[model samples]
Target: MSISEQEVRHVAHLARLQLTEAQLRQMTGQLDTILSYVDKLSELDTEGVAPTTHALAASNAFREDRVAPSLPRQEALANAPQHNDESFIVPRVI
Candidate 1:
C-alpha cells in the first residue's frame, strides 16, 4: 500500500504536474494513505451483500415517443449571432 517517491514523480509527470521535491514527498505519503484505506476496504466481509448498480433504487419511467412540431428554419435562426441560408455560422475549428 506504500507509494515510493519515484512512483509519485512518475504519476505527476503523467498528469502534467510540476511537483517539487517536497510536494512529491507529500503526494507519495498521501497516495500511500489512500491505498491503505482501499486495502482496508478489501478486507471487509461482504458474504451476503447483493451487488447494486446504483446507490438508490432507480427505475426508468419512460414516456411515449410522439412526433412533435419543430420551429421553422427562419424562426430557429432568428436569435442566432450569425447564420447562413441553411445553418448557424461558427468559428472554424481547422
Candidate 2:
C-alpha cells in the first residue's frame, strides 16, 4: 500500500503538527516505504510458526515466596516523629 501526501497532511493535522511543504512530501514518501515493507512481509508463509511476544525465549527471574517474621511493633515505632504505644500519629486531612 502506498501513502498519499493528503493522508500524511491529515495525520499531521490530527497530531497537531505544522509541517512545511517539503516535510509533508518527505513524510508521505517515508510512510509509503514503510507500508510497502509491511505488504511484502504479509506475503510470507508461516502456517506452523507459533506466535510469541518476544523474539527470544524468556523466563521469570523472581525468587520463591516464603513466610518470614515481621519486625516488632515497638521496634517499628521507635524512629517515628510522633507515635502512641502502637501506631504513628499524623496531621488530620480534610
Candidate 3:
C-alpha cells in the first residue's frame, strides 16, 4: 500500500490543484499511512458476520408512502413574490 510521487501528481492534476514539492511529499506519506491502516483493518477475522449497511443493529425506519390530497393552487401560490396564472416568475438566470 505504498504511494508514489507520480501517483500524487496525477491525483492533483485530476483535482485541478497545484501542489508544491513539499506538499506532494507530505500528501504521499499521509496517503500511505491511511492505506496501511486500511490494510491492517483487512486482516481482522469475520467468518460468519453478515454484511451490514450500518455498524449498529438497526434497519430503516422510514414510513410507507400514502398518496393523499395536495394543496390547492391558490394556497400553494399565496406566498410567491411574483406568480403568473399557473407558474412563478423569476429573474432570468443568464
Candidate 4:
C-alpha cells in the first residue's frame, strides 16, 4: 500500500503532532520506503512453513516455583523516604 502525503498529514493531525512542511515531506518519503519494503516481503514463497511462537526451540527456561526466605519488614522498609507504622507514606493525591 502506497502512503500519500495527504494520508501522512491526516495521520499526524489525528495523533496531535505538529509537523512542518519539510518534516511532512521527509516522513512521507520514509513511510513510502517502509511500505515498499513490506510489499517486497509479501512476495516471499512460504507455503509449508509452520507458524511459531518463538524463533528458537519451544522450551521453558524458567526456574521451578519454590518458596524462598524473604527479608524482614524492618529491612524492607529501611530505605523508605517516609513510612508510617507498616507502610511507605506519600503525599495525598485526593
Candidate 5:
C-alpha cells in the first residue's frame, strides 16, 4: 500500500497540483500510512450488518405543512421603490 515517488507525481499531475520535492516526499509517506491503516480495516468481517446513515438510530422530526393567508397586494407593494399599474417596475436589461 506504499505510494512511490512516481505515483505521487502522477497523482499531482492529475489533480493539477504543483508540489515541491519536500512536500511530495512528505505526502507520499503520509498517504502510504493512511492507505495501509485502511487496508487493515478491510479485514473485518461484516457480512450480515445492515448499512446505516448514522451511528445512532434516527427518525424524521418534521412539522406538518400548512397553508396560511397572504398579505393584500397593496400592503405587499407598499415599500417598493418603483412600480407600474399592477407590478413592480425594474430597469431594462439588454
Candidate 6:
C-alpha cells in the first residue's frame, strides 16, 4: 500500500503538526515504505503459529515476600530541611 501526499497532510493536521511541502513529501514516502514492508510481512506462511507478545520468552524473577520492620518515622524524617508533626513541609505548588 502507498500513502498519498494529501493523506499525509490530513494526518499531519490531525496530529497538530506544521509540515512544509518538503516534509510532507518525505513523510509520504516514508509511510509508503513502512506500509510496503508490513504488506510483505503479511505474506509470510504461519498456519499453526501461536501469537506472542515478545520474540523471546520472559518471566518475572520474583523473590519471596517476607514481612520486615520499617524504619521509625522520626528516623526517616531526621534529615528533612523542614517538617511538621508528621510530614515534610515543602513549598506549596499551585
lDDT of 5 by residue, 1-94 (tens): 6779899889999999999999999989988999999999989998999988899997899979989898888887888998775788889999
Q: Can you tell me which runs of candidate 5 are displaced by over 4 Å?
A: 59-94
Please list all clashing residue pairs in model 2, or write none if there are none: none
Per-candidate local distance difference test = 0.91, 0.95, 0.93, 0.93, 0.90, 0.93
Best by lDDT: 2
Model 4: weakest 10-residue lDDT segment is 52-61
Per-residue CA lDDT of model 4 for 3-93, tens digit only, reads 9999999999999989999999999999999999999999999799998888989788799999999888888789999987598889999
Let me know the TM-score candidate 6 reaches against the reference structure: 0.71
TM-score of each predicted structure versus truth: 0.82, 0.63, 0.75, 0.80, 0.59, 0.71
User: What is the Cα-based TM-score of model 1?
Assistant: 0.82
Q: How far off is residue 23 in model 5, in Å?
A: 0.5
Q: If both were scored by lDDT, which would come out higher, candidate 1 or candidate 3? A: 3
Better of 1 and 6 by lDDT: 6
Q: Mind sharing the TM-score for model 4?
A: 0.80
Query: Comparing candidate 4 with candidate 5, which one achieves the higher lDDT?
Result: 4
What clash count goes with each model?
0, 0, 0, 0, 0, 0
> Residue 88's C-alpha lDDT in candidate 1?
97
lDDT of 1 by residue, 13-91 (tens): 9999999888888888889999999999999999999999999999999988989998899999999999996899999
Per-residue alpha-carbon lDDT of candidate 3 for residues 1-94, written as tens digits (9 for 90 to 100): 7889999999999999999999999999999999999999999998999998888889789999999999999888899999995978899998
Model 6: per-residue Cα lDDT over 8-89, one tens digit each = 9999999999999899998999999999999999999989999999899999899889999998889878999998859988
